[model samples]
Target: MTGPGQNPNGPGAGLPPVPSIPLTDETARDVAGEQSVGGLVKDVMTQVSTLLRAEIELAKIEVGAEVKKALRGSVFFILALTIVCFSLFFLFFAIAELLADLGLYRSASFGIVWVAMLVTAGLFGFLGYRKVRRLRAPERTIETIKDTAAALRHPGEHS
Candidate 1:
């Protein structure tokens, strides 16, 4: 008869006593090697694997946060750009009409207005490119990766 958690044929079963002996030198050496180097190596590998998994999870979270921030910023920038573009269009049309009324259409006034519009478009494009570069700079991502790798490499160094 055995208890619920006890296996009838296992060591927990009521059985005859067994003899014990002192460990021999070769047996002791084998056991020591398994407990020391082998066990240590297994533990280190497990820790590193866990650390890498945690870092990957953190990277996913950080990337998602960064992407959300970028998207929100882009939305606001697009809205502002739309308003500015419409305002510029209206202002340019008004100026062109004024030049026409002033008897400048047959002269270089129309060409100058077109050239100015082209320059304005190019300037806005350049500004947008600069803004995107600033927003998506790799510095933050690189820093995060470096910090995470360092933490994983020396987890015990923190505290």
Candidate 2:
């Protein structure tokens, strides 16, 4: 059986009685009455400023990381482009020579390869332009900023 002044149905049935905190005027007023509206507003403004600063720092870190990744990728991409550009002359020259061997005039064979290369380049460039045109702004960051603004405007409401 639980002793008097002991909790009977908790995880510990005979737990010792906890000490009470004697409230002072400030604590009593904080617990039982409204704090001054000015104090409350100051506290909220301080917290919101801190939160916005943190958000800005997080965005900067995120953007910095992404920029580093893009820089690394672009370096490799440029290297590949340089190598391909140097190699294409040999490849197209071989094609032109093969065409000349197949009984076409040397000038005509070279001109045909030039025309074909131009058409292929134009096709790829158009496709890349369309793909880039479809790129959109950063949606997640925009959404988060919007949510923060809404929360700041209506502190009591939650999504």
Candidate 3:
């Protein structure tokens, strides 16, 4: 029966019949014989295995890159921190020297300098502790990889 965008009999009702490309029985058999269900399953399994292997390798590479980046960033941060600490130390020493020159050292100059140095050290130590905690915190990507690997190794284990 005719439908929308279709001829009443079939497609191309008014056109000449298209020439068919005849294939020999042997050719047809050869083409069809290679496409069994088992072969198709094997092909799919191979592809899945290949894709999984590539994904795993890529994950490993990314993890390594992330670790390297974190290390470099930490190194740079530590270096900058060291520079800042030294600068503060020098600044405090200069202040102490200025106080001594102004004859304030005989009064409470040493106490002030000592208190300032201790306070600065304590503040910086706290900040460093916080930074270290942040740096050592568990990464989401690493956690995801762990989860994925566990799932791949033992399917249906996660609840």
lDDT tens digits by residue: candidate 3, 1-159: 343766766633433332222344657767766888998789767755765565555555556655655665565456556655665665666565654655455325644655565566566656555555544423534565576578778976864
What is the C-alpha lDDT profile of model 2 across 4-112, one tens digit per residue? 7666887435333332223346676567877698988987777767667656655565566556555554554455455447547856676656646556666556656
lDDT per residue as tens, model 1, 12-109: 26532222223446677776667677877897777666656654555555566567666755654565566556556656665656645455552356
TM values, all candidates: 0.41, 0.47, 0.38
Model 3 clash number: 0
Each model's backbone clash number: 0, 0, 0
Best by TM-score: 2
State each model's CA lDDT, in order.
0.58, 0.60, 0.57
Give candidate 2 regions above 4 Å deviation: 1-29, 88-140
Cα lDDT for residue 103, candidate 3? 46
Displacement of residue 66 (Cα, Å) in model 3 is 4.5
* Model 3 segments more than 4 A misplaced: 1-32, 102-159
Lowest lDDT block of 10, candidate 1:
15-24
